[model samples]
Target: MTSIFDADGKQVPCTVIEAGPCVVTQVKTLEKDGYTAVQLAYDEKKEKKTTAALAGHFKKAGTTPKRRLVEFRYFEEDKQQGETLTVELFNEGDFIDVVGTSKGKGFQGVVKRHNFSGVGGQTHGQHNRLRAPGSLGASSFPSRVFKGMRMAGRTGGDRVKIQNLRVVKVYPEQNVLVVSGSVPGAKGSYVIIEK
Candidate 1:
């Protein structure tokens, strides 16, 4: 994230993104695929690293291999296979949504994950039960732990969508987008921006 100067010389925090010069690799139609969507390929990848089938797929689109491919269902603009799309699709002050994976926090405890207050009082000779999950299940009744329990396991690295972020700036020449506030994922991770 970085700060930018507004017209009033006020500094505004924003996230800079390389929007894209994405290529339309495939176009799915209602008749053929039972849906309408365009598969856009962004970033570059080596032909040797890509599978033969995928390489042929990129070849059919008249473009080199791409690192990421995403399909945008019901994209407002009409695009064809092998067409190039740039950041020009967005303009300053445009409201958009960004979808990306959040940073992984690995395995976390219930205190940090579920915000459970650890057995608060230390008066009754409590040992390390401070950060414990407290209880798992009832001893007899059901005889088992229930499903969908929010225990400490894996966290983060989930798909996150931040909506209604204003487009602060658009650099078509550089294919970059400066949006208000922060975005998901670690640095250099790919994100999908939608109108």
Candidate 2:
């Protein structure tokens, strides 16, 4: 993440994303695959690290092994196999949606996960009950706990889609895109950008 100065001389927080130099690995047709989608591959992977089956798949596309492969449906443009896609596909001021896995915050309590104000002031025998999830449910009324109760559990590490992030800048030569505001996922994680 970085900050950029806008035309109004205001500092804007932004995330730098390597948009792509993605290769069209496969083109699925409605007749052949029962669906229409374009499979794009990005980030080069070593030949030894790639499986034999995947190696054959890349061979068919006339490209080397790639680390990430994503299929985008309803692509309006007609792209053939082995065609390269660059950051030029997006322009500055355009809005795009970025999808990626959020950073994992394992085993978080309700105070952090659900934003529960833990037990309020420590008074009236409230010893060490600050961050506790106070009342779960009635003891004998419903008998058992209801489903989808907000409580302490695993958090983050989920597929997240951040939509309508304005494109602040585009570096087509380096295949980089700077978008306003923060994006999900850790550094170097792959994100699928959709227009």
Model 2 alpha-carbon drift over 4 Å, by segment: none
Tens-digit lDDT string for candidate 2 (1-195): 999999999999999999789999999999999999999999989999999999999999999999999999999799999999999999899999999999999999999999999988887887998999998887997888899999999999999999999999999999999999988999999899999
Per-prediction TM-score = 0.95, 0.96
Error in Å for residue 120 of model 2: 0.7
What tens digits encode model 1's per-residue C-alpha lDDT throughout 1-195?
999999999999999999889999999999999999999999999878999999999999999999999999989978989999999999899999999999999999998888889888878778878888888878898888899987888889999999999999999999999999999999999899989
Model 1 residue 105 distance off true place after TM-score fit, in angstroms: 1.2
Model 1 stretches astray by more than 4 angstroms: none
On TM-score, the candidate that comes out on top is: 2
In lDDT terms, which candidate is top? 2
**Model 2 residue 167 lDDT?**
99
Question: What is the TM-score of candidate 1?
Answer: 0.95
Error of 1 at 34 (Å): 1.1
lDDT of model 2, residue 178: 97
